[model samples]
Target: MQSIERAFDLLELMADAGGEVALSELAETSGLPLPTIHRIMRTLVSSGYARQQPSRRYSLGPRLIRLGETASRSLGSWARPYLAELTEATGETSNMAVLDGDQVVYVAQVPSQHSMRMFTEVGRRVDAHATAVGKAVLADLAADSVAQLLERSGMRAQTERTITSVGAMQDELARIREQGYAVDDGEREVGVRCYAVALPGAPAGAAISISGPEGRMTRMSTDTLVPLMQRLAEKLAAELRTASHGA
Candidate 1:
């Protein structure tokens, strides 16, 4: 059990350092002796979870991709019922997304009964600056962290409404913080608008959103929908916490 914990700690330390680190860096950060760290890393490398670079730096290996994708799919499946409930209540497409690196990846969705409703593919990755879910999650992060993320992923305009400047994004995030939700006003797509709220206690940065055409979304009363979304997010977070505890 101790070895397992140590291995995971090293992996997380490497991830925190942007997926690669020197052996000494892991020792310094983890306070583990060099020999112990080396033994654990060797086990991870042999098990295909980590790789040693030519520079002798350790990096996460490609094998973890399969594990990550499968876990994401499982999470999406588990959240579908919640998203379906949101869609049924709002009469719009509902989606759950998580912050992945500097992008927001859609993990689950329940399309509206309306034939012309908004729809996003489950695995689709969108720039954080352009989506309501992205903004909702980013709003919870520190200003410096948000700036670093934006600097890593350039704020390219997806539509005329997209916030392109860091100052403007900070302002938008401030508004989201004040309002308790975020809105994508034709930002990601020319005619689509979305409303999102951050999940209260997700293991990672996550948000749920309701999206539709500009006309329908604009006509909806945010005063009514935002609170409903917030309640659902809290409920979902509670369930996730329970499950994690059980595990």
Candidate 2:
């Protein structure tokens, strides 16, 4: 058990180092002796979970991407029923999204029954700066990390209401953290509004949202829907924890 823990600890250290690191860096960060880390990293590389770069830096390998994608698919399948419930309860389109790299990708969705409802294409990737689910996921991330991500992604305006400035987006994320939910008031689309909450303990960068027309999705409606999203997010988080441990 101790050995297994050490292996996982080293893997996490690599991930925290942006999925790549020199052996010496891992030794310094993990406080594990060089020989011990060397053996563990050899095991990881032989098992196809890590690869030694030409520079002698080890990086997370391609095999992990397959494992991650499979796990993400399973998680999306497990989350659909709950999203359906949210859609049914609120009469709005419910969505499940995961942050991949710098984009928010919709994985699962339950469209509203209404003819005029919002519908986000599943598998569609959108810049995190212009959407509610993106904001919700970003809200829980450290301010500096968020800043770094936005700096890389370049907050392009999807609509006139989209947050085009880092400072404004930072202020909004602060409010989201305090309020426990995030909102997009026609920021991504001219006529749409969305309410989102992060799924703590779920897949990394996962968030859920409900969206509808601005006219129907009013302030009073948001007050009610936000709590509903919070409740569902907690339930989903618990389910995700169970699934993770089982996996």
Candidate 3:
């Protein structure tokens, strides 16, 4: 049991370090002896759960992909009821997404009962630069890391409102960090608006959002919706953490 705990702790440390870490860095962060960390890492590497990089850093291995993907699928299944609750509360579309690679993927959604509503299909992938969920996920990251991500993704103008410059994206992300939420005002799709809050402990780069047509998702609606989004996101994060720990 102790070994299990230590191994999981080391994995968490690696995840927090962006899926890679040096042995000395892990020792420092985990307060584990160098030898112990070394032994555990060796076990992990041999078991194909960790990979030794050419630079000698330990990176999360490909073997974890199946586990993560499976878990994400399960998460989506359990999140539908919460999303349905959000839709009921807001009378707008509710969505859950996670940052997968350089794109954000919608994992779950609940449509509003209104004749006019928002729709983003589950499993749909969009560049992180043009979506509210994307910005909410990326907002807390270091500016330099965000810059690199944008450079790699190439922030094309999905619509005229899509932030097309690194400087502008940085400014918007800063605003999101300040407000603890992100808004997309027709950036991804014209006449659509969305408000999103990050799920801090839900999953890697997970967020929940409420979206509707601009005529309905106005500033007045934002005042009400953002708060609800935050609360629900918090509840969702707590549930996800509990589930993860049990797993």
How do the predictions measure up, each by TM-score? Answer: 0.88, 0.79, 0.74
Residue-level lDDT tens digits of model 2 in 1-247 = 8778998888777765667789999999999999999999899899998999999999987888788677667777988998999988888899999887678888889999999998878778899989999999999889988887787789998899999888999999999999999989999899898989999877578899999999888844667788888889999989888866887
Best by TM-score: 1
- Full ranking by TM-score: 1, 2, 3
lDDT of 3 by residue, 53-108 (tens): 99999999888878867866887887788899888887889999988766788988
The CA root-mean-square deviation of candidate 2, after full C-alpha superposition on the true structure, stands at 3.2
Query: Which is superior by TM-score, 1 or 2?
Result: 1
Clash numbers, per candidate: 0, 0, 0
Off by over 4 Å in 2: 1-42, 51-59, 201-203
* lDDT (tens digit, per residue) of candidate 1 on 89-156: 88999999988767888989999999899988998899989999999999998998899788767899
Using lDDT as the measure, which candidate wins?
Answer: 1
Q: Is candidate 1 or candidate 3 better by lDDT?
A: 1
Pairs of residues clashing in candidate 3: none
lDDT-wise, the better of 1 and 2 is 1
lDDT of each: 0.90, 0.87, 0.87
